[model samples]
Target: MNRYAVIDIGGKQLRVEPGRFYDVRHFTSLQEISRSDVNIKVSINRVLLICHGSEISIGQPWLNDAVVKGRLLHPCFGKKIVIQKIHSKKKKRRSFGYREQLTRFVVDSICLNGRDLKDS
Candidate 1:
C-alpha cells in the first residue's frame, strides 16, 4: 500500500508521498540548515490528512500527533513566468520575467503517534 499525507508548508498545502521529491517555496529555517552541508532532517507538524493502506486520518486544522519527516535537499528556482503588456495605439510595450526561489525536499516518512507508516 502507498502512504501519503497532506502537509502545510510556507502557507501552501501540498500532498506528498514517501520517497519522492518536491519543490516548495524557500523557507528561512531551511536556508539556515542548508548552510551546514549535512543531512538535516525536517519535521512538519501541520499535517492535514494521512492515508495508510485502508485507514485514513483527518485533522481539525492540523493533527497534533501526526508529523511528516523529510530532508531539505537544495535550493532551486521555479519556472520562469513571462509578462507582457501593450497599450492600444500608444506603441508602448513592456515585458518582464520572474522566477520564484524554491527549495527541494524529499519525503522520508510519515509518522502518526510516534509510529512510522512506511515501516508497515
Candidate 2:
C-alpha cells in the first residue's frame, strides 16, 4: 500500500510521499536551519489530506491531528524566468530574468492519529 499526503506550504499545495525530495519555495522557518550543514528534522502540520492504501482522510481546511516530518536538505534556486517589455514605435525595450529561491525537503514520515507511516 502506498501512503501519501497533501500539504500546504507558503500558500501552495503539494502532494508528497515518503522518502522523496521536493523543491518548494523557501520559508522563514527553514532559513536559519538551512545555513548549517547538519540534517535538521522539520515538521509541517498543515496537512489537508492523507491517503493510506484503501483508507483516506480529508480535513475541513486542515487536519489538526496530522503532521508530516521531513529533512532539510539544502537551499537552491529554481529555473530562471525572463520578462520583457518592448515598444515598437518608441524603440524601447526592457528585459530581465530571475530565479526563485527554493529549498529541498525530503519527506521522512507521515503521522496521523498517533500512528506513523515511514518510508520503506
Candidate 3:
C-alpha cells in the first residue's frame, strides 16, 4: 500500500498521497511561501509529509526535517452552508452562508534525500 505523510493544518489533519488531491484548510499568509523558500527554510515548519518506516519523529507543525513534494492543482470551494434565523412576531429574517477556501495539492512523495528527516 502507498502511504504518505499526514500533516496538521488549519486545525485539520490531512493525509497526503501520490497522485491524489486533498482539500486542506486555508493557511496564513506567512505559510504561503514559494516552493524555493520552503525548501531552504526550517522555521516555517507547519506541514510536512514523511515516508513511512523512516527514522523520523515529527513535532507539531514540524516533521523532523521531513519534506513533502507536491503539485498545486487548483483552488476549490465546498458547498455553502445556509443559515437562517427568523422571529415570528418581529418579522425579522436573517440569511447567511459560508464556504471555506481550500488549496488542492497532489502529493508526489515524502523523502529525506535532500534533507535529513530524522536525527540520523
Best by lDDT: 2
User: Could you tell me which 10 consecutive residues in candidate 3 have the lowest summed lDDT?
Assistant: 35-44
User: Model 1: which residue pairs collide?
Assistant: none
Model 3 residue 73 distance off true place after TM-score fit, in angstroms: 1.6
Which run of 10 residues does model 2 get worst, by summed lDDT? 26-35
Encode model 1's per-residue lDDT on 1-120: one tens digit a residue: 867999989989999999999999855564454445645678998899999988999999899899899888877789999999999799999999999888888999999999888645
Off by over 4 Å in 2: 33-35, 118-120
lDDT of 2: 0.87
- lDDT (CA) for every model shown? 0.86, 0.87, 0.58
Candidate order, TM-score descending: 2, 1, 3
Number of the top-ranking candidate, with TM-score as the measure: 2
Task: Look at candidate 1 and tell me the lDDT of residue 40.
Answer: 67
What are the per-residue Cα lDDT tens digits for candidate 2 across 1-120? 789999999889999999899999956575454466656789999999999987899999999899999988888789999999999999999999999988888999999998897544
Task: Give the candidates in order of lDDT, highest first.
Answer: 2, 1, 3
Model 3 bad stretches (over 4 Å): 29-61, 113-120
